[model samples]
Target: MLLVLAATGALRGVLDLRTPLVVTILANLLNIALNLLLVHGFDLGIGGSAAGTAIAQWAAALCLVAVVLRRARAAGSSGRPDVAGVVAAARQGVPLLARTATLRAALLLGTAVAATFGDAPLAAHQIATSLVSFLAFALDAVAIAGQTLTGRTLGAGDAEGTRALTRRMIVWGLGTGVVAAVLLLVLAPFVGGWFTPDATVHDALVPALVVVALVQPISGVVFVLDGVLIGAGDGVYLAWAGLAVLVAYAPLALLAGSLGAGLAWLWAAYGVFQLARLVTLWLRQRGDAWLVLGA
Candidate 1:
């Protein structure tokens, strides 16, 4: 998992994610083959599955490293790693790390709040949360495009291009969100049945899923703007924005926990959080504040 993460991050930095994406696909394919070969052919059970996964992960990492090196060579860049560059990279990444950590903390807190509601609500919440997470991949594809394009356009001093790209990407994000929302609503009946036999769990999941669907467009706008901010080198403000969101989200989350609010309310807490993010990001984008014109 760590290896894949590192490789993916490295690939994202250079806007060369195809290599890592392919690596992931191939690794998972290899994992399946190894699981069948080991677990079935060798008659090893769960241990074989674990070993297969470990082997696939390491192989994928190595493949990514080779691709990175080859790409560097082909690009004719001085292909050497240095401690100073590593330190500088880590220094630059601190704000992003803080942003990610705090966001994840909020998610975990939501889960804890759901757990207080009883087993059924907690189970339903997990399913709904998982649904949101899976849909996020689709939305993030637009954000990633925004990030790469924003960085390159800013680097080239094309402020107009940067603005246009941000606008277009935000539209794409919203469109993606709308699609996710429709899919979620359409799948509500069948999805709940696929997950569990408990009628209560299924019933609880349906409404929460609606809430999740309702928030998709909001989440979409927030995510794309987040990428634009990061790409424009507004990490400090982004970190501050994340902190402000934490403050806003905490009260609602706490209230939900204390009152044992339904799963929809907990997800609504997330909506508040995403709404705050949209405001923060829009403020930055409204002016030249995030427009670091050169380098």
Candidate 2:
């Protein structure tokens, strides 16, 4: 993962969009093939899946490094790894990493809490969360685009371009969310069946799935804003905002259980957290001169 991050950051600094996109797509395809081979053909299970992923990631990292070095050489640059540059990048990235880690940890905690409600509720929560994650991941592509464009615009000191790109990418992200929600709602029955043969699980899952579908568009916007802030090097805000949301998890879980709140309330907590982050980011961005539209 570290190597992949390094390769991506370095390549982003030097390469154009098309090259990296092609490489990323091809590498993901290779990784998927490796996953299938190890898991299905060899019956290596989850460990095999992990090993396949690691190998594919390292392979992609090496390829990206090679491409970057070649380009640097062609440009008559030294093609040497800049330790200072890496350090600077790490300084900016650490806070975002912390925020991401904290949020994921809270999610895991939420999962544990749901599991305490028994197999049916746990299964339902898992199905709903998985569906939500699929939508989030799809929208994240647009967020990444926003991040890349925002960074390049800042680097070029083109404030107008940054604002325009941000708005455009946000729209795209929300659009993806809407599409994911619609598709998931339409296919809920089929998807629920694929997860379990239990009619009870399916019954529990249906309502949660609908809730997830409703939340996707809002979550998508939040993710896009997150990407925008990260690209703007506003990781401190991201970290604090994430921490604040995380603080609500334990209390919320306790209250929900004690108050006999349903699975719907738990799912609603996710939407609340996301919405809070979105509002916080929007407020912060609005006040910051650096992030001001066309500033």
Candidate 3:
């Protein structure tokens, strides 16, 4: 993840879009190949899966390092790696990591709460979550774009530009969410069936899948807002915002009577959390006049 972030930062500073795009494609291809060989050819199972992923990551890191070194050589630079730049990036990243970890833990807690209902509910929740994961992949790309744009804008001392980008992202995000929701609603039953042959699990999962699908876009917006805030170096706010969301989970879960109810409440809470982040980020961006001051 650090290498990817470094590569992105470097690309933003020095390289063209095509270079990073090509590198990302190559890295993903290599990762897929490693996964295939380790999981299928060697039957290494989960351990092989881990090894494959680690190897692929190292390969990408090497590639990124080579790119950085080449850039340095082309510039006739003799100094060490950009320690200060890296440290600044790390400072911003640490809180984002904390926020992510806290959010993930809350998700786990939600799953555990669902499990308390019984095996059927647990299975349904897992299936719904898996579907949500698939939806998130596409949304994640948008979030990454928001992060990159936000960071670049802030770095350039263009607060107005950053605000514009954030608004555009949110608008597009809402539209994307509605479309994804509609598709999920239509496909929920079929998607649910693919997960299991069990009728009870399928029945319980279909509605949950629809709910997740409809709300996925909202979740995507939240994720994008998070990226924007983190890119702006608002780590403290990110941590506090994540903590607020985490705090909401238990009470909401306690109020839920059934697995579906719990999932619904969870999704609603997620949307509220994300909207709150958008509001907070907008306010912070507006209030911080220094952020717009010339470099």
Candidate 4:
């Protein structure tokens, strides 16, 4: 995971997104093949599945690293790590880590609440969350573009360029969000059966899926602004803002759980969380403070 992450980050810095995407696809294909071979052929069970994934990840990481090294060689770059630069980069990353951790904590809280509602609710929660997570990758593609371009634009001290990029990405994010929302809603009835044959779980899932579908636009804005702020090196603000939203969200989630609310309500609480995120990020994007121009 670490090696792949490093390689992807380096590739993103050079605006080489295709390599990471290709390697990821190859890795998943390799993982499926290895899992079939190890788990069934060798009868290694779950441990074999784990081993297959581990091997696939390592293979992908090595492939990406080789590509990075070759690129460096071609560019005549030293490929040597500078201690001071490393320290500075790590320092900058700390707030990002905090921001991510807080966001994940909120998700965990939702999962915990879902588990309290019993098997069917929990299953529905899992399915809905998984579907939303899958959709997030598509929406996040625009955010990735925003992040890369915003960083490059800001680094060159082009404030107007940064704003222009943000606006363009926001439009893309909204358009993608609308498409996802429409598709999710249109498929909500039939989608649950695809994941499970259990009628109770499927019935429980549709309402929550609808809630998820309704919030795609909010999610879209939140993700893009998040990437934009990160590109601007505004991690400290992001960390604090994320923590604030989590704090605000916890009570809402708890209340829904305590009231024995249905899956839809619980997911509604998550929608509130996303709304909070949108508010914070939107406010930041409106201001000039996040446009810190420099390396």
Local accuracy of candidate 1 as per-residue lDDT tens digits, 1-295: 7667766766787888788878889999999999999999999999999999999999998988777778778889678877898897787689988888878888899998999999999999999888888888779888887887888899989999999999999899999889988998899877988889999999889888988888999889888998888888788888888988898999999897898778888888888888888888888899898898874
lDDT of 4 at 200: 97
RMSD of 2: 3.2
RMSD of each: 1.6, 3.2, 3.4, 1.6
Candidate 4 C-alpha lDDT tens digits along 195-256:
89999998899999999999998898888999999888899999999999999999999999
Give the best candidate by TM-score: 4
- All models: lDDT? 0.87, 0.78, 0.71, 0.93
| True lDDT of residue 127, candidate 3 | 81
The best-first sequence of candidates by lDDT reads 4, 1, 2, 3
Residue-by-residue lDDT tens digits, candidate 2, 1-295: 6666666766765436566677778888888999999999999999889988888888878887788778878889897778998798789879988999878887787787787778898988898878777777788877877777787788777877777887887788788889888987898777888888999888778777777778888878888888888778889888988888778666776576566576777777776777777787777666654462323
How do the predictions measure up, each by TM-score? 0.94, 0.86, 0.81, 0.95
Query: What's the lDDT of the predicted structure labeled candidate 3?
Result: 0.71
Full-model lDDT, candidate 2: 0.78
Question: Using lDDT as the measure, which candidate wins?
Answer: 4
In candidate 3, stretches whose alpha carbon ends up further than 4 angstroms from where it belongs are 1-5, 12-21, 31-55, 75-79, 257-262, 265-286, 289-294
